[model samples]
Structures are given as structure tokens and as C-alpha cells.
Target chain A: MSEADPVLLNPEVARPYLDRGGDLPALPLGPEGLDRHTRRDLLKEEMAIAKEFHGGAMWPYAVAAFSCFAVWLAFFPLAIMGELNLTVGFVLSCIFATGGYVTSHEAMHSNIGRPGEKNRWLNEAVGAVSTIPIVFPFSMARMMHLEHHYHCNDPVKDPDYTDEAPNALWAWYKTWYNRQPGVDGSIHHYKRILAGMGTPEAARALKETMLLQLVFMAVLFTMAWSGYAIEAGLLWWLPRHIGLSYIRFYLSWAPHHPREGKTGRYEQANIFKSRLGHVLSMGMETHMIHHLYPGIPNHRTRKAYLALKPVLQQRGVDCSAL
Target chain B: MQAAVRGLFSWMPLLFGIGFIAPLIAQIMQRLDIPAPAGISPILFGLLIGAPWGLLTVVRGRWL
Candidate 1:
């Protein structure tokens, strides 16, 4: 393919550069147009095993996890009331806040309640409540997340492209840098993308984002005024910052690092060893599988990735990490 | 109206961080027996330090 090939705009390819300076590798994007050499029977065998992992059993776990996080967030006030130890509360809040995104993420992909399924309300409910710690609204998260999927490494279109950095330390710095006032990163960046889209979902997301931010600020101000500023800082504000940084590092940057020119589906995400391990790292080691088959629930991704590994390798995916 | 709201939201962190969190932190440090430099009052010390840092973040969009 020449430098001017139109395939660069395939929505899956990160194209137009959008001022993210540096040379993008000119590899052919993703698995599109590639023929799998597997016999029909063998291909069917691979798909059948993979399909077994995609289903609705994820709802119960999603609901239970959402309840735990909500209850945990509720306990923050008890610490302010002097009924709980602030140190203990802060530690637990950090754990819950960091873990909250994966559950909401599962709901974002509709793994909890797929469209037309009987339990779709439960999915939306989980998504709505799960991110209370991080203060990101479900509507905004869903809209932005879906767009990231559609344009994974797109610097201009991908809300998460801001997380892209040269190394782990820079990636960590970006999570905070993106949210600083006047920086078009994090929610601010998403607001720009949503404004450009001009869809009902985008509008709703923007509205929800505003309301959530107001509520978050009101709560912090209330706590500070009530002589519980320390409690508020440890319980919510600090935890949210730490959790956002961790979530962005593992969930966005690590999975899709060196994002330039990587617009293809298979090329978009990678399997890599996480220093924090699978559960601690938010199950991002198997993130590429989730990108390929979002319907597979988070808990089942490792198993499904193993089952589908041969087929992925056959299709030119880099699966050596697992 | 939305733009106005967004502008307010953008200014909030700096305002809250400097005005509330910084002074409160000063009080906590004092309680832990840490003395402010130049014999300054804890709240004044907090304001002295936080005001410039917060203004910088608001202007440059980063603290560091």
C-alpha cells in the first residue's frame, strides 16, 4: 500500500495523524481481507468453543459487584461520622474505586444485558451505579467507550487516545495531566468528541457529565464545610484520582500503546503481562480478546482467549504473551 | 448556558483545592506538630503556598 492509500481511513486505522507527531508504522490493518486457511469443519470447531463463553450469566455478577461498590461508597460518610476508621476506609475505598470501572465496562459492552435481552434494564442499572466512585456517568462512559472501539487508536476520534504515551511513567502522568483544568483530556476531551458527533446519545452524555460533575463538587464542598475535608479527600477525591490513573494505565494505554497507525482490529490491542496480575490489573492481559468479541464477559475472557488462541494466531494476531 | 457551566466546572478544582483543601491540610499538619515557616498562621501559609500553585494549574493546566 502506498502512503496515500485510502485504506488508512478505514475507521479501524488511526489515520490523519491529527497532530500526534511521529511516524506511524505502515503495516496492513487488522484481519480484514485475509482468508483463514482453516478447513470449514475446523473453523466451525474453533468458533463453537468460543461461542460457549458468550452468554447472559454475567448479569448476577455485575449486579452483585455494583451493590458492593455502592455500599462501599456509602460507608464513606460513616468514616466522616467517626463511626469508621478513616485510614481503613480510605484503603478500602481505593480498592473499590479502582475495581468499579471493570464492572461498568462490562455493562458498557452490554455483556450484562445485551440488546433485546430480557434483563437489559439490569445492565443499564449496573452501568449507572458502578462508576459513582470515579464520578463518571454511565451515559458518557458508554458513548465514549463505543467510540473508542470504533476508532481505537484514532488520535482525533478516540477519547482514550490521550492516554497514549511513550512509557509506563508517562502513561501514568497523562491520566492526571489529561484532567487538569483547560487540558482537553479525560472528560474534557470526551466532551469535545461528543460535541462533534451531534447525536442524541452524545447530547445525553454531555448533560449527564455536567450533572455528575456538579454533584461530585457539591459533595466535596459539603464535606469540606462540615469539617470533614480530610475524610472527603481520602475517601473520594484522592481515590478517584488514583483509580482514574490506574484504570487509564491498564485498561487504555497498556492494551493499546504505541497507538500510531494501529487502526486495524487485531493490531489495535495486545496481550501483555501485567505487573499487577490479571485481577489486580483489571483483566487487561486478555483485553485484545474483548476487543475482538465484546460479548464475552470479563471473567470469561481468559478462558475464551485460550480457547480461541489458535484461530487468532492463524489470523496473524500476536498472542505470544499469553 | 452549558458553556458557562463548563467554564465554572473547569475553574472549580483550583478554587476548591486552594481555598478548602490546602488550608485544611495546613491545619492537619499543625495538629501533627509541624510548624509553618516564618511563624506564619497555618491558614496564611496554606494560602501563600496554594494560591500560586492553584493559579499556575488553572493557567497552564498542570501543577508540575
Candidate 2:
């Protein structure tokens, strides 16, 4: 099958497909019948099969999960008071910060609360607050993430395309390189895109980003000046850098490697086995399911992906890596 | 705001090293009782090392 054109996945369409599932037929679709269907048909069938796994107000999970960030934040004061060891704090902070993106990712897709839904505020709140550990503003992340979805692997338009590299080691290095001050990747690239958009939403995101950066620096400076510099570095700054690298590697680079020419819905993201496993990789091993049915929550993607693997194979997606 | 951002970033790396990292290094050196060269203050010694490293990282985009 040829690579499908890169087209926007409509959450409105994704919504119906995300509803609670109906009973599956006693037998799965046969190989002969699947072969007769096009990729789009298989995509719909896959969505139908996985629909059972996702729905309901995810705000509770979002709220409960926020304690992870709370705990990470608390490590700062705890370390300062000598109640917690800096080495232990640093390690836990890294894990919490690494996991922060997935919670915010759900909110980016409105899985926690769909637009116009009553709990939508909670979605935005979760999205906004969850990534403080990594110093990423939700407004910027949401806008750029939506763009990545619409553009997928379009080298020019995809904000995440910078994470692409020829090999694993370079991919890891690109994550750090992209964050360098002079680089036109990462937040700097997002700034350029926002400036070009000139929309109210874009302007607001830019404003929020600037404000967040200021706050981050202010806190670091304050902590340092107050003799808590070690606490600041161990609890927040170093952990953030580590988290960004890990998140960029697994969530951005790994799923979409060799991103040069591929732009299809099925071609943009692939399934891969992570040495860190599904949970440690932050549910990104099955990221193809996320690109297809974004409404599926992170915790459920593994099961959903397994159930949908047959259809994904039928659609000519490369499942060999998994 | 653009100017402010630019201005802030111009010295951000260096200032971060001086204000945050240097103090940490100084504290560590003091705890370990590592003598600063020429009897320079521990904080000064930390700044001497951390500031240049930060400057290089900002310019070269890597700590090493």
C-alpha cells in the first residue's frame, strides 16, 4: 500500500469512535476480508475494536495522578530542610518529571475533557499544571502538539521533526541540541511558529511561555540566593533537562524515526519495542494508537494496541519492530 | 518583551552557573574540605569553574 496523505484527524470524528464499545462479533475479521478493505477501512475497524477501552471522565485520573507532580515539587523543600536526601530526591524527581508529559499529553488531546464538555476546564487545568516539573507551558505544548498531529511528518511544518536523526545516539544528542539557546528547534522553533500564526490563541501561548520562563528562572535564582542552590539543581533544573531528553527520545524521536519523506497517517508513527518497556517508556511504545485514536487514554493504549494489531498489520503499518 | 527575553537569555546561562551551580559546588567543596587554589574563596573557585563551563555550553551547546 502507498503512503496515505497526511491529513488532519478530526477529534469530532474521533469522538464517536472513542465512545464505549459495542459487542464484538464472535470471530475477528478474517484475513481475506481484511485484505479486501483499504487502509481507511482498517483504521475505522481498528478504532471500533479499541473503542471499548476508552471513555468516561478522565479528570479523576488526571487529578489523582497530579500527586506525582506534587510529590516531585515537595522534594525541593524536603531536601532543603534535610528531611530528604538530595541523591534520592534527584532520582525520584527524574522519574516523576519523565512521567509528567503523558498526563499533559492526554489533556492536549482533550481525553480528560472534550471541548465544550463541562469538565473541559479540568482538562486545561491538568494540562497546564502537570508539566511544571519540566518547565513546559501547556498552552505552547497544546498548540504545537496539535500542529504535529495535523502535519505529522511534514519536515517543514512538524514541530517535532527536529527530533529526527539517522541513528539512536544522534537522536539522543539531537534532543539536547534542539534545546540549545541558538537552535531553531524545541521552544525556539515554537516561538517562531507562534509569532507567524498571529492568532489570539498563539499570542496567548507566547505570553504564557514567557511568563513561565520568567517564573522558572526567578525560582532558581531565589533558591540559589537563599542557599538552596543545591536543592534547586537536584530537585528541578537537572531533573527537567533529564526529563526533556528522555521524553524527546521516546515520545518524539523513536516513534517517528526516518521521518524524512513519510507523511501518511499510518506512516508517520510506528510501533517499536522499548527496552524500557511500555510503562517505563511512558506508554509511547504504542504511540501509533495515540496518533490514530487520540481519545484513548495513555494507560489503556497497550491493551488497545494489542487488540488493534491485526488491523494495523492489514493497513501495511510496520509492526515488525514490536 | 522580545528585548527582555533576549536580554534575559543573553546572560541566563552564565548567571545560572554563577547564581545556582557555583553555590552548590562551593557548598560541596566546603563539605569535602577541598582547598581552593591560591586560597581563593570556595564560591569564587566554584564561579571560576562553573561560569566558563556554562559559557562554553551556551556557545557550543554541550557541557563537555
Candidate 3:
């Protein structure tokens, strides 16, 4: 889609609206524009360039998931046996758990597997297992994520865009938590939307996984009741707490906020210009370009954005987010 | 059936909010007998109680 053209500076310099009493006409479509054939050809050319860094590898996601699992699980026993400080162990485990969630996010997008029919389910399954420790249901998460993409930046329609007005951090927190009842009502509706799209089986799969939250609760209680409250708190609860906050604050707030007052549909997306922000956010920092072409997997979004930088600039699309 | 499920879920955050806070309120009343802080409005107290419940309901967010 084309960016909105600037309005004419002088009424005499504008094409007059036939019915207008005194209004200047909007940008008109014309014969002098790029033809349909050329548009398609150019898009195909850019996508081909994007494909070079677009990954279809499962090993990296697997390695990230396994790293989280091993490091987080190992922290428990070592802390219990007094080999490592409980607080330190807990802090370190939370960091690794956040890494695991990055894998889960990739998995949700079906980017953790080879681009093939058979590997789709494999990706979802790996995501499900990887997210269990964080109390996330993969199928459910997939549904919501698709909605986020489908309705990005829509205040009413998108679940992620809660605060429509600007406010301080504490004010937003208080508004989100203390004020709202029945929050995330968008999720139940989005589930129906997904099911209606011929993925009823995926919806049913999500329903079945709701019990896992209870199972997670039971696991925590069992650990706490067995006189390992500190261990349970650190290894289980703390890391997941970190995971939850990291997802909300880092992945959610940081990537979308700081709009520099430009809330136009294409301009509102946030990008990380800093290397640390890019690394920490799993490459979601260069987000506006990714949103332009959602099919370009996360690992390669930065590369794809850079590849199309000239085009974005020439089109007058804002890349200041980057 | 879909509407009914949706209605039920729409109430869940409110229910979970009360569930999470009612016990905490009870514990405070039993142990410390804490009163509403001086100069705190009833509306503010209500919000404080509701916020954690809301926070807990959503912190297990599926997306974002």
C-alpha cells in the first residue's frame, strides 16, 4: 500500500473537487504511475532479496529451548544443595527462562522448522513444550499472536494496544491492573475468530491445554508444601515471573511505544537502533520493516529492513523507528 | 454455546481478581487488622484491591 501523499499547499495548485465549495482535492490515481505488472515484479524482487537471510532452521530454536531448560532446571538442585546462593541462582534462571521464551515466540510463528507441510505441527509441538514452564499454551498463544498481526496498533481491536493515551509508567501499570476488570476480553473473541477461519482443531487443542495452568499451579504448591518454598519460589515462580514481565515490558511495551508522537499506521511501530536492544529483544527492535512483510521470519528482520531501506526512504515511509 | 463461554471468560478476570485479593484482605484483617490508610479514598482502595487481581489475571498473557 502507498503512503498518503502530502496535500497541495495552494488551492490554485490543486485539482478542484467538482462538488467542493472550496476544498482542495486529495491525491488522484493516474496513468503516470507504476503499472500492476511492474509493482508485482518489484515486490517479487525485494522478497527474493529478503529470502537470503530468512531462516528455516530448527536447530537454533532447539538449542535455545534446551539451554533454558538445562540452566533453569540445574539451578534448582544446586541451590537446594547449598552449592550456589539461592538469590543468585534465581536471578540467573530468570534470565535463561526469558531466552527460552524467545524460542517459544519463534515457534509460535512457525519459524522454528523447515518451511514444509510436515514441519508445521512439529514447530507447534516444540513451542508447546517449551512454553509449559512459563504457563503458556502454544495453540492459545498462536491464536492471539495472529490477531496481534492481523490488527496491529488498533486500540479497540488489538489486544496488545491497551493504553490509547500517553501516561507515565506507574500510571499505565495502575490503569492496567487496578482499574480494569475482565481484561484481555479480546482473547476469547479472537479464539472464535481463529476457529471460524477453518482452524477449529487448533482452537480445540487450545481448550485442552487450559488444564496445564492448573498443573503448573499444582506443581508449585507441591514444591512449596514439601518445605522447599525458597527453591520453588526461585526455580519455578521467579523465572516465570521474570518471563512474564519481560514479555510485557520488553517485547510488548518497548517495541510499540516511544512513537515520537507519530501514530500513523505505518509510523507507529518501534525499532531498536541500539545493538543491545536488538540482541535483548531477539531482533524485534527493527520492527516496522518486519510488520511491512510479516512473512520475513524474526531472525532476518534486521537484514530485510536494511535491504529495503532505500525503497522505504524513497516511498516517504517513516523508518525513524529504526 | 460460544456466547456463553465468552460471557463466562469475560467475568473471569473479575472473579480471579476477587479470588486473589479476598484472601489477602482476610489475612490482613486477621493478622494485622490493617485499616484503609489515612487520606486514602474508598475509590483508590477499591482500585488498589482490583489492580493486583487484574494484574494476576493477565500476567499469564498468551500474547504481549
Q: Report every candidate's CA lDDT.
A: 0.80, 0.81, 0.59
Error of 2 at A236 (Å): 0.4
User: How should the candidates be ordered by DockQ, best one leading?
Assistant: 2, 1, 3
Error of 1 at A198 (Å): 1.7
Candidate 1 - CAPRI tier?
acceptable
Models ranked on TM-score = 2, 1, 3
| Of candidates 3 and 1, the better by DockQ | 1
- Which residue runs of candidate 3 sit more than 4 Å off their true CA positions? A1-45, A56-58, A77-84, A114-122, A163-182, A185-199, A202-209, A258-268, A272-276, B1-64
Question: Which residue window of length 10 is worst by lDDT in model 3 chain A?
Answer: A178-187
A1-322 per-residue lDDT for model 1 (tens digits): 4323445456455443434664544543332433232334445776687789887468566766677686686776687678988788788888778888888888898888778988798888888888888999999999899989988898888889999999999999889899877788988888888888899988988898889988888887777656667788888888899989989989999989889999875689998889989888778999988887888888888999888888777667778888
At residue A236, what lDDT does model 2 achieve?
A: 88
* Recovered share of real interface contacts in candidate 3: 0.03
Q: Encode model 3's per-residue lDDT on A1-322: one tens digit a residue.
A: 3423333433444445434666543353222233345445556776677667666556777777776677667776786676878777777777766666677777777776645767776676668767766676777776677667777776654655653335447424623342233343323444445565576666664564546654655565455434455566677766776666566555656667653444554465665564467878667677776666666667778878888776555445556756
lDDT head-to-head 1 vs 3, winner:
1
Q: What TM-score would candidate 1 get against the native?
A: 0.86
